[model samples]
Target: MAFQTTKQTISQPLLDTAASLYCSASPHPTLKSISDQLKSQGHLDITPLKVRRLLITAGVYKSELASQIQSLYDSGKTITEIMGIMHLSRTSVHSYLPYVINADDEETEEENLCQRPISLEQQKRCEQAMEQFQKDWKGESLWEVITAFAGCTFVTSKGLKFTYEVKQNRHGEPTNELVISRKEKTVTKATVIKAYEKLLELSAEDSEDGITADQAKESVPPRFPIPLSGPKKLGTFGASYLYPIFIKLGLITEYPMLSYFHLPFSDDIV
Candidate 1:
């Protein structure tokens, strides 16, 4: 299939409509149009640094980061390579795990799948980006993007009640944001108390949907420490060989070593 990408023009009508479309609610022609125009005009007045910020924010605020990341992946850059370009850290990298892993309950299948560990400087960039994100994303949730967060599971979304996480680049850094959504529940202008009520409702729903709902469980993720029902056995091979590995190989899972207690699945990690 032949493809043609048509960039938006610096049209006044589009500018007028952008506030409803863009989150910042800025009145100017959005970063998207600005980028489109710069790419169209190739003017130095729009500094490369500014253009890059526009690009990153467009990917973020406009909710296009995932597709941009996928494009990088399609080009064969390792996850680490992508991380450097995006400035994401270990948390951000793992957040993307849900999107990249295609196998069923198979963590091993995805093993050695990450590109490379980010360098110290690159990691610093990620940290800085995250700090900025914390400042800006304090009260807002993620922008809804296409093919973005494709693998990210929807935590919950019910008007005023909303929660989601986003992993993307911002100002040349990779970062993750844990977003708690807020919207007026309805025609009713939600007061602080009303908002709090909605939050409680959302919380209950999340507890039910999150860890409690076995049916809603994710297929593959890193294993956390599991709890055992009783005392563990310690011997020559150490904890490594003592507990049996029962979870499937494809996905990360914690096997119950004891009937009803809490412990790390890798009781073997000495």
Candidate 2:
């Protein structure tokens, strides 16, 4: 058999447009946006994938941060620590690392045979479990459940384990369950409330406490303790464990302007 190769040519004008558009000061352009611009301005129709390929060929899409992430990994930083510092996911951190191979390249027939695709029934069960987990993990119902199941340990999605110690009144009836950390410290619920109050106070002012509305807008919920002294400072670990629970209970709002913090599933930290 004889083999023949055909060469595919891309016009210089198209290359120039892609380069100019990609390097522009405007926000990072998506492939779809780049394709749209090329079609409108260059009068050439192209797909987003093709635009991506052209950019890659031109060396316009550079992995500048990948090297830095790899350097951190080489310096003995854990994946969780790297994710925390870079505000990236575990998968993303792994992707940025130099030695990790692409998933497609790593896939094999044996692995495929061993791994079963999730059945519809299994998927439904998973969805229900996730839904129930979310529902039971936070809010007034969570507090109720904790009071009912005092002394039982529960784990969060992030694998943070905690339990509630039942606080009894004079009649020996359980009044409230004190959130207990893995370190055995009692977390004061009032501290979490106070942190939210501080956030509210800061958010209410136009420019007070050195926190601007824009800064508050970009802020994640405080990690707890609220930088205060005494009992508030005691539960840094415990308070963090209950922070999500407080948010669900409407005790800690994200900001004064916003009613509640809609926690993201991707948030690895509780």
Candidate 3:
């Protein structure tokens, strides 16, 4: 007689319990421990290897480090930032990430694996630019709107002021920098006008203090989701800290072209 293999039918409740144990448990339970736990809880006759295989098939058994890496990436942290936080090499970070990160050839080369730290002079220049931006724009919300519209031009303008880009390695990638950009098909000329109109209404309500970034976001939530960092953080509700860069980059020059209606920067901001 030939030996036959049996197909085990795992319940949804069991899968949920397994996922909970894998994620919520301190130090994470081993497969054998999970299997034993399941067995004790009335899920009899399952082996540790079978439990592991089932979890893999269910797609809930991904590597913990890989999950963390992907979460950081989704939250807008740079590859370098992820590596530093995890204390792993760039290649290690790349390999663990679920999606492929677009790395330049230089980053992967053995001779140039580690990136050079930003020099004090370069850091100082960026700081100076940031200081100037703060002075030019006091309010956070209005500043965010202007920056989102201008994007790369604003980043480049800051670079021009300091003779180098703030994020040198990510000079051309506006979305990668410290700003919240609308996803494709989400923003349009009409939507931009509507946003400004809403801002003006909010400004009229509290003419003295003007509207906050949170207020703007609540009034007109963007089609794309913004990551939730904190109440004071940028990009939470279409607001950002890069407002100064936009101002320095001559965002005022494009105001006329942004909308046919009179949308004065001075009136909306400061």
Candidate 4:
């Protein structure tokens, strides 16, 4: 197909050509190859970067960083918020954003007000992104998981609840916030963390002597540890979800697990 371009944008035929070359090619044509092909078809200004830009705009590009940015955006994060959470520059975030969000755009405003629920596919991507972030995270921010699960509400086995949402700060920029509640009373994130630590402490005391193989086989499976009476009371949510995350991020130690011992069968005898 003949490729054409205008001063501001490449023609649909040209964009479609780039998409096809990159998506349908057996060995996967490189941007250079696509550029050459387009140039041969009378579009001489085509360069590798332009070809890449076209593919990116067409949503056919498979860039890890770009996908990460798009995923964050899909999760209701603003450009500035994405930059802060990802440590990326504004230009970098904008270049990879899958959708446009013009300031005066009526649709954008309406969408923001509506705050569409995160779809399953988007949720899966967000979860994967959060996992990756956790792996690469340093001691930078508290409640970093909020980045991926914004606009989500999670409930614990008990009545405690956790909500991850974004709100405008004093500077009129979007920022992540975590809210915890139980029995209609607000709880602080610090309070939750401390309570979890205390529970771990208590659990550790319960297992301080450690369990032998015989004891482990006879003992019933242990559920999450929770403090019965204390100023810092971690409900079911803190014990199950928050505890594991704390262990993973290295913010707290993992509770010990009893090792199982199996007996040899009769076939093992000589």
Candidate 5:
């Protein structure tokens, strides 16, 4: 969201661009005036409609806007529903309705609400993250590594179960980058091996050893579960000492830290 800049400076190119794209949707006073001011600053007279068409033809505008409108119409999504998700007022979004909506599509059973398609900017960020992860990872099996990063569920071809963070680029290329993030912690596999090696070395040292791998007291994988005798809450002390170490070592197989709980936090997500 920070990438969407404030509207007061000479760096008003983006505002100009957004206003320019208004014709592809609908004309608006606020949008029109903003466009005029921006063009005037360059000492040129430009029509709002002309700027609007330029965006539709080319020059870094979102490709999916028209596609989303078409999809919504086919699914019987009303003009009101489209405007709500896009944060546009009813008047603005509906202006282009006659051009795109089809009689057959209009007759289809429509849902009262439709989630907005994910924005182009979000798609870009996802791609960048994937590229960076690939650049950093030296492992042979990359998918397994990235799947762990996102704290999401994944079922394999042969029915093997795993998880990951999935992303895509503008051209619809997908990237599955694991979450090795200390804050996000959805990663597993090799990162875990590296973390395990570090912790194991630390535990095995003759000096002030932080961890001691006691014999199987329970069937848990890590073997050394710290004992805190009390009822637990979300993000409990049990999670703190244990999770940080597992995360730092990159051995954490669980996507969300809270997934270990009896009731998953999925309910909390909309």
Candidate 6:
């Protein structure tokens, strides 16, 4: 007569509970231990073989088992000792060891990575720029300063001049559009001051159109809109590049609703 295997019937909830217990337990309990706990506490009659099948079916057995093996190995346990504790053979232990080691190495690499340090000269130039920005800043929000500074032009090493323009949508909303142009870039504090002064000069010239300097200043806010609804808004791409400098100069204030919005943009400012 041939020997027959018995099919176990367990509920989904019971299997899920067992898996949860297995994951949460420190030094994670074995299938046999889980079965015993379920029978004692949960009052569910589950065999160790059934628990194993359930864990495997849930797709957690291999990874969880490997984690347990790795934890034991990391604690300086010998392979033979791990074999006795986890009931895994040398081949199984060897197969998972590389993954564990590689994971740790990747974590170490990430931790070691540091941000590139800003130079003292750049810091001085940034501070000078901020000083000019503050003297000319007439708008209510720091976002206005960011937009103005973003519009300031700087010449590249090859003498290619570039500047940014805050593009607005049809609804008069400022999108994340910092349109770069090859116009004469304002590289110095004097030039930035002159740029704003020139705007006021132009606004004065357009007095016949009823556009006062104050109105022109008010117009700057509309160039970078913050919706009256929803959470309090911050500046966009142009804002991110200037944030570190703003922090250094104590220009940024902490408010309940205010946050720094980081959007994708080139941080390379001349």
Candidate 2, residue 188: Cα displacement in angstroms equals: 3.6
What tens-digit string does per-residue lDDT give for candidate 5 at 70-168? 465565434543443343445434322322223432212222111223355554553554455345432232333333334323232233334334444
Model 4 lowest lDDT segment of ten: 261-270
lDDT of 1 by residue, 24-121 (tens): 44443444455455556554344333333333333432224445555765754444434544545433333332221123422221222212343455
Please, what are the lDDT tens digits per residue for candidate 2 over residues 61-180?
A: 545465556676675444544554455655555544422223432311111100134445544543454345344332333344334334444443355656656666789876544647
Q: Show model 6 residue runs off by greater than 4 Å.
A: 1-8, 42-44, 63-270
Is 1 or 5 the stronger prediction by lDDT? 5
Q: Which stretches of candidate 2 lie over 4 Å from their true place?
A: 1-64, 70-178, 181-183, 200-270
* True lDDT of residue 216, candidate 3: 45
List, residue by residue over 1-270, the lDDT tens digit for candidate 4: 001111243366777888988888665677778888889999998776667666787878766666666786775554544554455555545545433224432112111211346676656655565566445432223344434545544433343445534445799775533433333333345544454445444554556567553443233332232223322234533354454334222333322322222211111101
Task: Give each model a TM-score.
Answer: 0.18, 0.29, 0.22, 0.30, 0.19, 0.21
Tens-place lDDT digits, model 6, residues 125-236: 4456545545555422233444544544433323344555566779988755445564322223333333334334444444556776656665532221111121112222
- Candidate 3: list runs displaced more than 4 Å: 1-6, 63-270
Q: Candidate 6: how many backbone clashes? A: 2
Instruction: Give the winner by lDDT.
Output: 4
Local accuracy by lDDT, each model: 0.30, 0.46, 0.40, 0.48, 0.35, 0.43
Maximum-TM-score candidate:
4
lDDT of 2 at 227: 21
* Superior by lDDT: candidate 4 or candidate 5: 4
| Per-residue lDDT of model 3, residues 76-160, tens digit only | 4445445545555555555454321123211121111112333455445444544554454323443333333232222222222
Q: Which candidate order results from sorting by TM-score in descending order?
A: 4, 2, 3, 6, 5, 1
lDDT of 2 at 220: 42
258: Cα error in model 6, Å: 66
